[model samples]
Target: MSPSPPLPKERRIRWGYWRSMMKIELTRQNVHNEFAKKVELISGQNLFACYQCGNCTAGCPVAFGMEVGPHQVIRYTLLGLEEEALGVNTFWLCASCLQCTSRCPKGIDIARVMDALRTVVLRKKERKDHVRIPEFPEGFLEKVPQIAFVSGFRKFLS
Candidate 1:
């Protein structure tokens, strides 16, 4: 009947088309090489296991002052914006109280991530201007030896 409508033309499937689509999507999303690798490294914490329960954010003491908060920091890292993640004052201001880590549903050591970010920032020569904590506070260097001895004595007793 009417040659069965000439049998509808089959849609062409091209592997190259799929690849190009993927590339376009990634680029549109601002995803790049550095972000990919950084996400993989940070995922070692099993953060992908996180379900965004918000416990880490709720428990973080310095979350109020954070540019992106702990949860968003993890997300930024996962997205490969390592410099953006580490550049936040939150990384330096963290109290390291472990509350976020302890409360994490995925059991991620958030404190460890913070420490790792700080280490990365410290090792970068370009980040010297980003140093938040002074190596020696005013008048503190003059009493260094005395402070060291007292600290060492306290440690020995403990």
Candidate 2:
């Protein structure tokens, strides 16, 4: 005889049990750095608290467009892999819509973390604006709506 499929309630219980039993530990020797400190200060989040569960990435609406998912970025940051953390377009693609924050089981405000990374990237003296107003063609700015131009600048610069 074929086995019956699990009921919704039973499925939920099994899923919860599975989640509770899973544990991920950080194995890297170096876990702290100036970059992580800066991110924690700016975002008011403990980078080490994230265990790479990927709930944030799973819920992010813009994750499809990101070069790296939010959870991976957090892992990179915690590991002091600044180049890996900052090199991806994950933070840039974040909509700041709070979806990731809402889905994080650890109560981490991941949107704030993305914002912090953006701030760090922009504040660096060597990094130039990915898109500068002065670099745009004169007619392009005039043709674009004021709100669009302002929002673009804020997204790329701030």
Candidate 3:
């Protein structure tokens, strides 16, 4: 008899999940494949190529401070876990230093992927508070050039 063909990742995960006898139900409706496709379209990077090697996370300087880290962010995006991916502080915490991107064996441009996620979240207005341009006190504002505030907001909000 021939061996069974390998299951797709989503199915394999679900199969293992059922074997574990977990009470949680897998919600197919919650996943939107278009999100992943859009990220690839905008970033021009194949994020699905990432195999969870953790190289991105290992080389990330700010990984210690990130709630989800670099690899998890990619995995979440690849799996189409939109809410879970966007809910974390990973994108906000990313320094865009490109360490993860450079070291990535797949040349996936992990930084761009994170930026794409943030852009989608911002565009959709899904999280109103994702990247707040904090209002500086009037006193501090007066001391600094107006351009400074604008530049700073442009830098961090991206």
lDDT (Cα, tens digit) per residue for candidate 2, span 72-157: 99988987889999999998888888998898888999999998999889888887546666787778877989977765676678
Give lDDT: candidate 1, residue 3: 50
> Model-by-model lDDT, in order?
0.65, 0.85, 0.77
Candidate 1: Cα lDDT at 121: 59
The clash number for model 2 is 0
* Candidate 1 lDDT over residue span 56-95, tens digit each: 8898888888887777777666566777787788767777
Query: Among these predicted structures, which one has the highest lDDT?
Result: 2
| Alpha carbon lDDT at 79, candidate 2 | 76
Residue 146 lDDT (model 1): 86
Report residue 151 deviation for candidate 3 (angstroms).
Answer: 7.7
What RMSD, rounded to one decimal, does every model reach?
Answer: 13.1, 7.0, 9.6
